[model samples]
Target: MDVYAANMDRCPVYASFFGAMGCACAIVFTVMGASYGTAKSSGAIFSSGIIRPDRLMQNTLCAIMAQILSIYGLVTSVIISGNLVEKMALHTAFLQLGAGLAVGLCGLAAGFSIGVVGDAGVRASTQQPRLYIGMVLILIFAEVLGLYGVIVSILMLTRSTLGVTDCPY
Candidate 1:
């Protein structure tokens, strides 16, 4: 019985540690994705001979929005995981972590799509309808990632409920 109790104690600790690591991974991936998207978008604008001061400001604004969204996801994940682990169950922690990743990925996709579409739209406003269509499609596709994250979170929460232990706090 002592050995079994020791093992149970270790499980929660491991779960918490992994949950934190997962949150960190999500944050890193989100930031990298945002940076890549920003660079690609800005480079496109510059290459198109439209890198005027006004366009620079617009690009900067879009990048800032992306950063904000990514940071929000990171912070939210940390808080939610902590709360779920402390007040709910170990599995809840994993669910929160997964949800955070989903949200971060969605934000990354949105940032990239927005940057690309905005730059392309500005550059080819006078010459193309296809670009606009592509932008809409990308936005829709990016939103799908967020939806999947929500679904995963829901499943996690449901599973946690089925196997709940007494709350630590």
Candidate 2:
């Protein structure tokens, strides 16, 4: 038998465990990032809103942006989880893990950047409304980082066959 089969015989559950870990990582990390971003920016937004109540709605965009990070993770997790099975291939498991990491880490990073920038931007925009445009541009760039991760994870997942047959490569 092949080396993978031999290993699977020794530890049948490991492959599925890896896939489950991937799903967990994708959801956990992204949620953590979203939470951090929301907490960081919400305080600033509320404080600034008290000064200019009319700007409250606009400032809320920061929290909304932070929440998007969690959505990225949720999407990635759902995709990865779809491939999980009781007897996944080791290679497939690793691929699933990689896919999760790609999106999770990127979303985390984007969330952090969004939080810091959102907090500062909201505060600054309260002083000079023109800064709002610049902040949005920067936020968009930060959000793109998470988008890149999702693209890469999707590409990786496309290669996973779930042990139906050997990998093409």
Candidate 3:
């Protein structure tokens, strides 16, 4: 018999609550970031479009890149949801929470960075086409920040277990 079996009180429905919160965090924070990025970049796109209509497509890439941040959150949330179990362990719940936070916070940061850079980059590049390459490079670097979060979250979630530790059922 496992020592944890004796402490059944330690295992409670709150475990599922934590896991659910994780899912919510993953979705909410990321979407917020993506939305912010999109709004900022879209404004820049319209402003820049007035100057150089021909470069509209190129500037649109900024908004598209911003949107990708939300996808990262979506993926993390789905994975965390899948890991949730009827009789979840506290360890697993914490793991899920960590995974969600890792992705959520990182994605938020990335999205903000992308939005600021995209807004400025798009506007500037419209005047000096030579700056387009630099803007793209910066965007790639900002995008990598979210990717790092996804990788970390995946690693954390992978360690979670769905085993029943002290559930009555």
Candidate 4:
């Protein structure tokens, strides 16, 4: 005889709260990161543009790269939010949280990397146009970090439908 209430197929209202917060976190943190990256890298644009105005468009790559991070977060948040149902399980909520956090934090990291590297790359390119290729490579690497997060979050989102009894372990 079980003394405590069996969680079985129970679907509590509180269970959905976590998923809701997760969705909010994904977009909020992503926007914050994109803002930071753009602001930090914009300085390089202003400084470098004065010397080599022709490369201003190329120098803007860093901020553009950083902004992609937020888009990833938005994608995942939408996926998670769409999955949210009236009878959400705890595990589903946790899954959303994990997905949201992964994308959001990764965005922050990508933003930081783009900001610093972009600033330096933009400045350097002003003096040496040949450095543009190297800057592209470095920015690509930084941008991929966010890609990894998006991919993982997408994979994690698949588990949202599982119920308590669905765990194999």
Q: Best by lDDT, which number?
A: 3
Ranking by TM-score: 3, 2, 4, 1
Error of 1 at 25 (Å): 2.8
Per-residue alpha-carbon lDDT of candidate 1 for residues 1-169, written as tens digits (9 for 90 to 100)? 6755654663455566556655665576667656765666556556544544444443344345445546645665555555544333456566656766765666667666656665665466324535545554554565455445445544553464465566443
Global fold similarity of model 3 (TM-score):
0.92
Task: Give candidate 3's error at residue 16 in angstroms.
Answer: 0.5
lDDT of each: 0.55, 0.84, 0.87, 0.83
- List candidate 1 stretches off by more than 4 Å: 1-12, 47-61, 84-89, 126-163, 167-169
Residue 139 local lDDT, model 4? 91
lDDT per residue as tens, model 3, 54-90: 9999899888988898999999999999878767777
Estimate the overall C-alpha local distance difference test score of candidate 4.
0.83
* Candidate 3, lDDT over the whole model: 0.87
Q: Which ten residues in a row have the lowest lDDT in candidate 3?
A: 160-169
lDDT of 2 at 103: 85
Score candidate 1 by TM-score against the native.
0.60
Task: Give the TM-score (vs. native) of candidate 2.
Answer: 0.90
